[model samples]
Structure formats: structure tokens, C-alpha cells
Target: MSNFLPTLQQNSSNNFQGDENNLQKTIKPQRGFKWNSKQPQKQQHPAISSLNTPTHNNSSNSSNKDIIDFNYTPSHQLPYLNNRNFNNNSNVPKLAQVSSHKDLKKLVETTLNSDSVLEQAIKLPKGENINEWFAVHTVDFYNHINMLYGCVTEFCSYDTCPKMIATNEYEYLWNINGVPKSVSAPDYVKYLMQWCQKIFDNEKIFPTDSNVPFPSNFEKNYIKPMLKRLFRVYAHIYCHHFNEIYEMNLQVLLNTSFRHFCCFTKYFKLLSNDDYGPLLELVNELS
Candidate 1:
């Protein structure tokens, strides 16, 4: 019985050692087991091996390098990131290369002189919905004026432009409630921008839904006043700030925008003859 017990113990010990060896083989530590570390290190999974391996593709290497060295610098001059210049080899539009008055004029003429555009313009608001037509044109004019104003805002300062009146006029005063007062050009521009912004922001007045009834006398009261103010802005720019416009090389854009506005207003009989008195010759020239 004592000899049988010894044999049984030896057999049990051999089985336990075999089990331990199988477990070690299954685990297969990436690095051999370390005695110094208190905790057993986890072996890296096979999936992670690809991530550890270096890539040889040139494009991938350049992209990785760019990612590693990426940094952002804030600019105070402009609000948005600059767009990359179009490649000379690429088939970019000629308008994309516009930097001079001649280039701008060519682009403007190419766009406005198109038979399709003129035909479309002539047939605007084909249906009898004047409110919708007015709303559409109002938004269009607002955007155009906003862009023109933005182009020269940096240069249009109180120091440079003391009065709102043109060089030829004695005084350009805005009257309200039987009170006539002259304001600085910058202040006048700010007021015009605010007025337009208010109209644009009011969805109730200029609802996107066609079914919504436009506010009563919106065209007579709101639109007329808006157009009058816009004309004054145009007049002021033409008379006092032509040099600034020229310097910015935005003459073609300004001219085209004004011509379109004049055509729209004339087609609808929105503006009286007197409203266009100041810019009559200039309008004729542009047309």
C-alpha cells in the first residue's frame, strides 16, 4: 500500500507539470517572462502587430509627417482660413484668376451678356405674385450690397470719410420726424447695414413659405424705403469712394450689381425718375 501511494503521488505531479507547460505554450509571451516586474505583463494581441509595423508608401509617410507636425496660427486680419491657390496646370475658371479691372469686366460681361441670363431676367416672377418677386429681389439686392460694403469696409473709416454726402453735394442729411441731421459716412453705412440685416432676419416679414401672407403695405413702405437707402449708398460710393473701389479693382462687380438693380427696379416701376437723378448718366453708361 505505501509503494502504491508513492506511484499515485508521482503520477499526479507529472499531470500537473504537463498542464502548466500547455498553458505557458498557449500564452507565448511576446517578450520572455521577467522576474523583476511584480505583475505579469500582457502579451500583445496579433491584431496590434500591423500597427507596430512601419508603412513604406510615400504618400502615407508624407501625410503621417504632416499630422505629427500640424500646428495652427490664428489670424486677426481675416476671419476664415485662406484657400489654396488654384494650380496653373489645372482647368480652373478664368474668373478664379481675376485680379484686375479688365479681368473683372470680362467675367462680368461673360456672365451678364449671356442671352439665357438676359431672357431669364426679363421673365422674372412670370406669375402675378409681386410679393414673392419683391422678396426675391430684395434678398438678392441685400446680398449684393452686403458684399460691396464688405469689400471697402476696411478702408471706409471716419477719419477718411467725414461726411456721408458726396464730394459735389453740400450736405447729405437724413431727416426723421421733421428733424434733418447730417451723419458721418461710416455711421450712415452702419445704419444701412443694420436696417437690411433687420429685414433679412425677420422671417415673419420675409417668410420662406410662399403661402404666408406678406405684411400689409410691405412693398410700399418697407421696400421703397430700402431701395431709396440702397440708391443713396450707391450714389455715395460712386461719388466719394470711386478711388477706393478702383484700388480694390471691384469696379466691374459694383457696376454690374448697380446695373442689375436698376433693371429690376425699372422693370417693376418701383423707383421714381427722381430717385435715379444723381446716377442717371452713370447708369446709362453701365447699361
Candidate 2:
């Protein structure tokens, strides 16, 4: 029984050894591998690394291109060409200016006189010198001159000649006929205006010296004297009597005063009318 026990023990040991061998075969490790072994994955090409890296060409290219375009061009330069030729040194032509119609008329009148037709038409009657006829017919036959004496008496106390204001008054009222007390004022106003027209016509003769330019002072000194005479007549007519006719005439006279107040109030253009025509215009403006 002891021998049998020994043999059984030996068989049990062999069985254990075979079981160990089977376990080794069933759980064997893969061949040719180590914990640190890899082919390094055939290192991917640098081109592939470059593609993954952040690059300005693709990431910021549109914005960078916009900046370059903004900074590259100058605004004022001629579009495609690099150089420009500016001609700042040349002189520009100037346009001529035109004179107004009224100014043109005055310019002509200042230098010229009426042609022959006016002179023949305005000649004095046979056997009458011009000045004598003008004085006798136009001055109310010295009645205006006589009134000048009264004007002197009434207003001559002031430093300046009463003739200044007084003559203007006298000329405005001279033609009213009948005794001064009874004379109607409208008739007086008309008389004065007509008298002024006559004096204006008499004084404005084309200067005897045709070659000489028309004097600038002719209207102021000569034409103004006539208007002032009329103004004096205006004053006297108003002063002596107050009436409805006088009031109406006074309003008319005042309304037209500006026409007279402006220097000559005449149409002074030459070659258009007789020199006397401007004097008549002066009377119209004043009266």
C-alpha cells in the first residue's frame, strides 16, 4: 500500500506539470513586440506638418491684402500714370464787362453835342437875339425879377443868399396872374412850373465852343438855379394863401421833388435830342 501511495504521488506531480504547460501555451504573448518599439509611423512629411501649422498666408491674407491696397495708392494722382504735368504758370483770358443802358447814355452825352438839325430848329426868331427873347418871354416880363426883390426883403437876413431858397420858391409860383391877393394857387403852381421850364431851356445852350467837352457843372450850377427858382415860387404860393387848389398843387410838387432833387433830373444823352430838351426834363422832375 505504501508503494501504491508513492506511485500515485508521482502521477499527481506529472499531472500538475502538464497543466502548467497547457496554461503557458494557451496564454502566449505576441512575437517581436517590445513596450518601446514602433516604426515611428514613417514620420509624416514636413509638407504635412506645414499644412497644419498656423500660416499668415491663409489665416490673415484677406485683411493684409486690404491694408496693402489702402496704403499703396495716392488719391490726388492722375489714375494710372505716375507723373502729372500741372500748368499753373499760364495766364487765363478775362471776359469783358458791359455798361448799363443809362450809363452808356451819360457817357455819350458827356463828350458829344446835338447834330445840325437841332440847332436850325431851335434858332431865335428873325431880328431877335436869343438871350433878349428868352428874358422877355420867359421871365414873366420881369415880374419874376420884381418878386426876386420881395424875396430878398423877406428872407435875406440869413447868412446865405435868400436867393438860394427864395429863387426856388419864386420860380415855382411866378406865372399866377391877377393881383397877388386874388390869384388862384393851382394856376400859380402851373405858372411857376412853366417859368422853371423856360429858364431851364434858356440856360442849357450847347456850349458855344463845340470842341470843348460839355462841362460837368452845367446841370448843377445852371439847371439847379432854375429848379431853385421854381422852389422859391412854391414857397411864396404856399405862404401867401392857403386853399384846396394850393394843397393839391403842393402835393403834386412834393411828389415830384425827388426828380428835381437829384442833380439835373434831365435826359442828358447827346445826338438824341436838342440840348434844351434836357432842361425841359429838369423842369418836369422839379415841378
Candidate 3:
């Protein structure tokens, strides 16, 4: 045990208490050592100086080591860019398109007005070919049919419009080009409503104080036809106009002034009366 203790002491002295003569050897105190006051941070060392440079080797050791340089850009521009134009006289694309349409219309009109084109277009075909009168008559017939259909349809479309009379049933008037003629009740109602809307939407029945009164002649010519048409067709009549049922019923067939038709009862008292003799007489007189 004594031999082992001397050997252990010799090893401790060599490690913890180095020879004072060797400059490279260090002697560290046992557990109760004080802090070293002579040591300084190596700020002037070449390794540290390299680390402070902005070179690649210095950046390699930093937290942002992998960050690469790039020129970033945004996706969209602000609305003001729409107003930016280099040429002052350059019109917008939409305006140019509209101008092109106007130019085309003028060119077509000019061409049609030329002597050869006008003469050729006006010339009639030979041997039962297309005649001027035939074209006119065909157009007139279709126009009349369309107008009549529109009038009736628009009037009958109103929720309050009266049911059609027995004569107004969807029956064949005539076969056209082998096609069966048919006009549904709903079709008639739709046309009637459209016609009525056109006429009454902006029409003033009676003038007001602020406005100049419409001329009496205008009323007699224009307004009278409209009023007659409306009275003849619109189904419901209230107190004021029920007395004129004869005039209204007869006017339905004679007048073409109404754009659309609708009717209303004029007076409850007259409507309830069992004696419709006066009304019948008025209708007969008109007819």
C-alpha cells in the first residue's frame, strides 16, 4: 500500500505541478484555483481577421451562410399604369373599333347610291321572278300580322286582363305553306303586355300644373286613339267609364291607335244593373 501511494503522488506532481523551467509546460492548481487575470481575447490573430472580412470564407461561418443574392420584383402594377401612354394622338382600341363600324356603314351606303348598283338592285326579274310589288306586299302582310299579334298578346298578358271571348280561341285561320296555323293564348297575352308597356310607360293621361298642357288637336288625333284602344281591350272597368261600354267594345274592331289593350269596370253600380239595354244599344249604333 505504501509503494502504491508514492507512485500515485509522483504522477499527480507531474500533471498538476509542471517544472518551472519549461516554458511550454503549464501547472494547473487543484479544485480551489482563482480566475486567470492575464489572459486577453485574440483580436489581432490572422484567423479572426479573416472572419471579419466580407469574403466567401467569412460568410461561410455566419447564420445567413446559404443566403444568395437576387434581384426581386413584384407581379402586378397599380391602376395608374392604364392611363400611361407615350403617344398623345393615339385613340383607345375601343374607340377605334367603333370608328371602323361607322366607316363601313358609310362605304356601304355610298356603294348602294352609285348608278350601276342602284339600277341593278331596282331592276325586276323576268318570267314570274321576284317583283317589286310582291316584295312590298309580302313585307306589308308580315308586318301587319306581327303588329296585330303583338297588340293582342301584350294586352292579354296582364295578370288582370280579361279572358278571351269564344271567337278568340287558338284555331286555324288558314294554312300557310302547308304549315298549320296556331297561336296559343299565352303567346297572345305576352304580345299584348309588351304593346301596353310601350304606350303607357311614358304617356301622361292628364297634364299637371307645372307642365304646359298638350294641344287639343294632338289629344283628338293621337291621345283619342290610344284611349280608345286601352278601353276596348283592358278587361277591368271601374266607376268612371263603364257607361261608355258600347263605344269601347266597338272601338276594339275599328281603332288601330292603341299600342296595347287593357280593360277595367267603370262603375260597380252600372256593372250590377240587370238592364244592359243601353249598353247594347250604344254598341249597335257604333257598329
Candidate 4:
């Protein structure tokens, strides 16, 4: 393995800049009216914050969706990337990798309770360096979404879901290199995570050595774009698999995780109004 001791500044900078430009362009303009919600936060699950998610009582969230017994395999995952062996998450940064060992199997087990999730999201720890703080939480949020989505992989198949959609209105298409591709939801999500994984694994982008400062454009160029895409994963899961999430009694944990994600993104202003379009209402209603 090559140590990312010194960044080839010109090359690395140009590469990410090119990627940023490509990411700025969407496959098609997302159709929606943008408005800040002044709606009162509705009551949430006892263990989570008030969110604009469908309650279990909602008729659309049937407890008995046709669930298949298939394990999802990402057909397009990078060859170097293999199945997670939970015991060794060397690929993940040190801070993000901590404390997760206590419960990897219990997907519903959340690290934060309702009262603390939002409060914790916005407060940078007193001793923490901001970029380093972002580095850790970025990895944390990624893992949270990753585990949450893993729960519904079998249900969100290419045949079952042709497009990566949220709210039945916003359909997300993947950008391959510089070209946009209208791929299946599973494929689109897989491609998106791969993009994030690549960034995290690259020390220049997310430094494994704390001594090596984060790249100059790390937050603006990498973190925001990465988190923006991660939000889509949440949107897709909430829109398409909330029923399954509800059935498994994971809705509270899912809601809490998503709330934490939203609060963090909102605090940092990492995303624009356009970026949150799919989940805008919920975001606006976040208490």
C-alpha cells in the first residue's frame, strides 16, 4: 500500500476540481418548489426527534410489504473493496472506527438518544479541530447510512426499483466520471457509495495521518459533495424502504440517524437548498 505522505498538490487539486465541476451538473433539473417550512414540528417517536417522516399509522407504510430473502451484492463495487469483516475496518478512519465494535449486528441500536442527537450534531467538541471533527463525523454518518441501507438491500433491487427515487417525484441519476447515467436505484446507490469510499480511502482527501493536514479544499470540495450524495441515500431509503424499516422496528433508530445527519449538514451549511430538494420539507421541519 502506498502511503499518502505528500500530496501531489497540482494533480490532486485538479482531479477533484474536475470532479466537482462534473458533480455540479445534474442529469436533469430536479423539479420542485423551494420553500423554508415554518410548519410546527410534529410529535416524533419517543426515542427520536420530531421529523416529517411517515408514522407507522400512515396507510402507505404497510407493515407487511413483500420482503424477499436475498442478500444484496454490489455487482459494480471496486475490485479492491471487499465485504466488510466488521472486525477490521482499517479502511475507515481511526475516529469513525471507534466504539462501533460494541454493536455492529444490532442495526437498530442508536448511539444517540432524541434529546442529544440534534444538540450533539451542531456542537463541535471543545478540544476538537474543525476539519478533524468533520473527518470523524463524515465517516460516522457514512457508516450509519451504510448500515441502515444494508437492511433493505434485498428489497431495493434493480428489477424492483428502476430509478433512485424519493417522494415519487425526485429521481436521482448517477454521474459516471463526467457522464450522467440513468441507472437502476441499486446501481446508482452502489456507484454513489463507491465514490464516497474512494474519497475516504484516499489519504490525501481524508488524511489517515493527523500530521498531514486535510487538503485545502477538503471541506468545500470533498465533504460537502460527499455528504450531499449521502443525503440522497437517506432520501431513497426513506422513500422506498421506510416500510421495511418500520417493519423491522428500526424506524426510530433510522429517524434518529437521519435527524443527526440533517442537523450536522444544516449546521455546517454543507448543502444548498437545491441539494436538500428531495428531503427539503423534512429538513425544514427538523426541530
How close to the true structure is residue 175 of candidate 4, measured as C-alpha lDDT? 62
Per-model C-alpha lDDT, please? Answer: 0.48, 0.25, 0.24, 0.55
Q: lDDT tens string, model 1, 57-161? A: 122322211111101110111111121122232532222345544554565676545546644553443344567556556655655665566555555668877
Order candidates by lDDT, high to low: 4, 1, 2, 3
Better of 1 and 4 by TM-score: 4
Tell me how far candidate 1 lies from the true structure as C-alpha RMSD in angstroms: 35.2
Instruction: Give the range of the ten consecutive residues with the poorest summed lDDT in model 3.
Output: 6-15
Go through the candidates in order and give the clash count of each: 0, 15, 23, 0
Q: TM-score ranking from best to worst?
A: 4, 1, 2, 3
- Of the candidates shown, which would achieve the greatest lDDT relative to the real structure? 4
Screening candidate 1 with a backbone cut-off below 3 angstroms (N, C-alpha, C), the clashing residue pairs are none
The lowest-lDDT stretch of 10 consecutive residues in candidate 1 is 8-17
User: For each candidate, what TM-score against the reference?
Assistant: 0.58, 0.21, 0.19, 0.64
Return the top candidate by TM-score: 4
List candidate 2 stretches off by more than 4 Å. 1-213, 246-287
For model 2, residues 78-185, the per-residue Cα lDDT tens digits are: 111111122331322222222543343333333212234223323344653333223222223123322322222322223323222211212221222222222233
How many pairs of residues collide in model 1?
0
Candidate 1 vs candidate 2: which has greater lDDT? 1
